[model samples]
Target: MKWIRKIAGMQSSILGINERNLGFIYPNNARKNYKYADDKYLTKNILHSHQIACPLTYAMIDAIGKIEQAWQATCEWNELVIKPSKGAGGKGIMILKKKNDQWFSQSKPVSEQDIFTHIANIIFGIYSFGDSDVALIEEYIRPHDIFYQIFPEGVPDIRVILLKGVPLMGMLRMPTSRSDGKANLHQGGLGIGIDMKTGRLKEAYDGEKHITCHPDTKHPITGLTLPHWDEIIRMSLKAAMKFPLHYLGVDLVIDQRKGPMVMELNVRPGLGIQLANREGLKDAIYRAKQENLLN
Candidate 1:
């Protein structure tokens, strides 16, 4: 907990998960907004209505019977992402890349039956928080060259915490061989803190150790400025305003061609973001409150 004190500086500013949920998310986020952030299909629709750029939805399957037709419809797409519409923690996400009529999942060839069963399980709610869920197939994002030079295998995304439509803090989550090509911290990815004003990497941590370079790529991670920095900030704020929730965690991905696109929105965003930024949320939280921005 020493790092907690170092980040918070004062005991009063320290916020625990329970406190955060009760004080911020519970009070600020409405129930209706939860559906928009929880369900991928609903999220896409909302973003579409707001004219916010996001990964294009290729297809959606809500029943097991439609799995075959859905798969067939996506045959023309050489690269696609299949995910549970209401998934959490990056679970139930399958990335498929086509090669000469063969489909592969993370370099391992997967049969058509394999893809079918996975989608079936998703519809049955195996990854949808124990409720019936829909499967979303969307265009796969080819990460920008700047990120590819760091870790070329997986898609890296930036998580920005916004309060009352104002950008607060941000972190760049990079995928490693350990995270199995997913930019999820609990899955063994790296969390690199970013300067809120500049969108430049400042500090990085690989879950346990402070790092200046990526553990696997061995590439220096700090001091590099992200392209479309200002747009990313503006996009995040715009996305927040579209939702009823005042507190939000907006995920953005920089595609090689599409530029910055909204990946997802979280009403109850994880606390790992605080660790990633190497700072406490209390200062920003209190500042927003004092400025009447939380209203």
Candidate 2:
């Protein structure tokens, strides 16, 4: 079956932020329920309790005094991902790998002091929207082998926007040299469209123009279908049902071994996905409404 009901011959209606906030976010999701999607640690708690697929959290620090304790607990791992609990837009996220007794981030050596400083900044709300935030130290996720063809390294994430627990639209965000290995469109990465029914990738959009292949690797990326498409959908639906929020933007990554792991959720997912898919959220919502599928 098609992921969305067909609306033939009609033009796709672009969804703007104002409309998104008013139409879907405000009506479907209440302000008090935002924490289900806003806080990374809280989101993971739901995932963990439900036994859903996600990266294992090594440690979390919410106070300056707990910094050393949290770091010491998770520092034994050769690799770790540090991020703000309430961060948005991929901010305050760092990956540290141990190489020959030295910790490194993005292939550059970082001192033990550097790791501690980053975590302190996270707790102080440096990368968060609030004045203070929790720091999450999680096991680093290794991207699926299929992504190596798209980029030499870096994990690309799949963003699935859902309404009323049903999948609406999807996009594959991949990293590039300019994005510093971060797969966010606004950070100079590429947003590749996804075929909802086929799970195959469409063209790549670099926040400006659409292309068919990776700009740096020159590898043909379009038409390659991602594995475990059905499981990915079910995994998303499980998380959505666990939360009180009706509107969600669920971010996930395909781990080389774990298949699909939920990364985080957003009550207010961006509208740039429209450009990535060359389709519109307005159009998808309208179609879902007509089919009585959003119930």
Candidate 3:
């Protein structure tokens, strides 16, 4: 009931309320990277500065001046992840796996020339909002085999929603046929509720209501307790404290060997979290407030 009211309150614009709720809310202008909630480059910078756990970034080429060198730099790590710094919703990301001194992508193999061209396009910002975008070459995480067993050839991540530096609610995002290998809820993936107190997964929702099997893999989506759930929640809260924003959604992936790594921070997290939990995020927010999270 609380979640329903919270979800309903958030959509006040549709509720025919002409009067603004300005006092109870802060305007969105003060938030950094508001337009791009999950900018990979900005997320890395925030994580790195705070010394939070994240995938190591090898190189970041933010301007045309550093583009050529970024291309020529032979990555020490054979397998790497290249993605637009400002990209979100799982677009413009490429994973390069090394085999026998040659580079192979998730879908295709590439040569040195191919890598250079790709970097060039990144410098040109072909895959981003504008020509001013940057490209990040980061450590590629071999996701834990347990999750991979469910969604092989894809990375499954957990999304933790934080309100005022407190872990409020969470969901495990699993890739599905509709998402094309992405675990984003809107992209046809599945969202499974995480018990806030126990950190165990409770149920699964497909951006709407309860669902058991993945639409693509046909795999069951419930009853799997996340590894390092408490640690992950602690890390999410700690990471949020480092940022200036009051409300955010932090995504993380657990690597087989690397543990937990921050994926991205979303300033304007989607309302899908409500449906995923089968409860409103508003109730969690109120609970956190009662615990003095605003302080």
Candidate 4:
């Protein structure tokens, strides 16, 4: 609420999608490098090639026949995340946590048949960009204690915007009960803006309301500092450099044991990130270009 009053006085620096496309996306991103960032499987392979840490892939199912094999291989693990390799906005991601020998998705018990149907839809491009996609079953990361304190139900991830290997802005996304335990802002999750310099919480927004505390957890979201702040930025920048793109959005998650690992890379990252930071991205973009950082 306090930030809302301050927002009026502050000159808006929001970067519109048109400007983003003309100024950053089209000029910076290349068609050749899109595959590495757009496809989750390829992203993992590329990250592994560069020795960058990411969620471990247990198995990949490209067809219906492979689904049974992949599921059997993953059965040994108590928890696993199965998702469309080319999915966007958290669509078709099933997180299975085993309890008392039963698998559950979002705490609801799911049968092997249900999972198979989901994977079938993924292979049919139901969750992808109208193209056939593979299903990637990966190790589910358990976030650190700090994230648990903020929101105990779902995984929280940080999105850092980078320009030519420099981190310009960042935000932390926490899932709410309404989001069905998915850390996506469009799906009722909380977006807390992070100060890029210190990785400290600067502001919080939930799509509709701007607040200081989480609506569900009632935990204060401001002034909280992310663990391994510097490492997060470093890892984001490192991942960005691996791509040929001049601008990128690197999503990083903090594993309880691993510290920081890249979850995904976005060549055309959403502009909603500016809303979380309470700052305009246009200024940062102009600055980067003027400094020749875009080169």
Candidate 5:
């Protein structure tokens, strides 16, 4: 009921799917330049060119013949993340750790051939709607300590929405037991609103209802402080300005050692953020425009 009360006055300002596409996405993001954001390898290249921090690429394999050699270069690393460059919804991603010269995923032993097979599957585009894709062997991020106590299983991230290089709203995504360690809100994870100016936490929306504590860890949700808040916004806007897209959703993760690193960029970001923040994008967009007019 409190959550309901919080959003009571914002009903008229909600941004729905249709309005989002026609008003924000289609007009601002060009189809030809979507590759800069849609392809993981290409996104990293853009981030690298602008000196924006992101996960390090160990290798990129586009052909079946090069899979073995590319993966070999990453052998010295204790942990690695393999994913499809054009994958979506967290599909085509594999994380493995090494022990005794063996790789294990989710604590289950997997053979070297199994790793090769997964990489080959990525190259064949099994995850990108049947289009050929590249395999990205990159750095595995261990989230910072602040996230460890919240939920230890998956890597949580922050989503910042920006338009014309101006940041508007922000949300923190955290994993829940039901989400199977995936921080996607639709997959049963939690999306908590953020006080963009103060970097303070607010109520969390778990798809159905508003909750103040983590369902899995029993940790408090509101008023939680996020570390490196400035860096996250700065990098998000940096990438936004650097890209051709005017409207954007910049995703970022706080690495245990590296601080905030850009994870991905989205030209057509979701609207679930309104429920998380108990606010509407319409109002945010208007406010940003007003501010821009004055300055």
Candidate 6:
């Protein structure tokens, strides 16, 4: 076991060395917060200003406001997502769906008071980096039904990795037992590699190795071609182009009627995308440059 661990560590070091040498042409920063930290607020403000089509922001309640009033004001949206403005990895977030004149949190029945308490908890940063400072109430879009069938009970979204404002790779994240119904791959969800140009699932991998069947569903995660692949890639490039950083990942979700919406951006995206795609990311970015897409 020790030998195996030692060999794995040595291999990782070798990869890290290769990645660093490649950094001259392909930029990467592992220490800084990227789109996930700044993109949500920036996206909310920018998209709202240009009317580029986004989830409607019904309300933004700080931790110290009239929680009940905000809850009442948001009751009519029918379906909505209550998310901490600064939360990451799908923590401190709640989904409210209206059923027969009542709203339920993540499908559990709840009342107006229940929502107030929940939002208040968000303000307290129950699932955030710090105290829940503020929360956003936005339209809860019903994802395309076909994708929903794959994720079941949760929202399965896409993550496109971009370098120098060009889309290089993409993946479809499916909710699994590890992710607790969230599509984030690092949180234990499944990451199925996407073809750079086609957006089709080519291979699937959990955190460790290649996988054909979901750890929980026993269903294969491959063969599902994502809808609106071209548009999703374009949106990712457009969003990344707006930032000063050269490398980033864009999280996008396609709605049933509204098309693709930018969910958030991540500056320091996870590198597991390489394993999911069955290739080294360093090679993909190099290809992107050779084709002169970065300029």
lDDT (0 to 1) per candidate:
0.87, 0.86, 0.72, 0.87, 0.88, 0.71
RMSD of each: 2.5, 4.6, 4.6, 3.2, 3.2, 4.1
The parts of candidate 4 lying over 4 Å away from their true place are 1-12, 286-295
lDDT score, candidate 5, position 43 = 92
Tens-digit lDDT string for candidate 5 (42-107)? 899989998999999999899999988987788799888889999987787888889998898766
Worst 10 residues of 4 by lDDT: 1-10
- Model 2: lDDT of residue 253: 93
lDDT of 5 at 119: 91
Position 23, candidate 6: lDDT: 65
Poorest lDDT segment (10 consecutive residues) of candidate 5: 1-10
Report the C-alpha lDDT of model 6 over 21-129, residue by residue, as the tens digit. Answer: 3563245543443533353665577655654556778888884567767777888777889887777778767888888897777567988777777788878877666
Per the 3 Å backbone cut-off, how many clashing residue pairs does candidate 3 have? 1
Tell me which of candidates 3 and 5 scores higher on TM-score: 5
- Against the true structure, whose lDDT is highest? 5
What TM-score number comes out for model 1?
Answer: 0.94
Instruction: Say which prediction, candidate 3 or candidate 4, comes out ahead on lDDT.
Output: 4
Error of 5 at 124 (Å): 1.2
TM-score versus the correct structure, for each prediction: 0.94, 0.94, 0.82, 0.93, 0.94, 0.84
Model 1, residue 100: what's the lDDT? Answer: 94
lDDT, model 4:
0.87
Candidate 5, residue 48: Cα displacement in angstroms equals: 0.6
The predicted structure with the larger lDDT, 2 or 3, is: 2
Give the local distance difference test score of model 3. Answer: 0.72
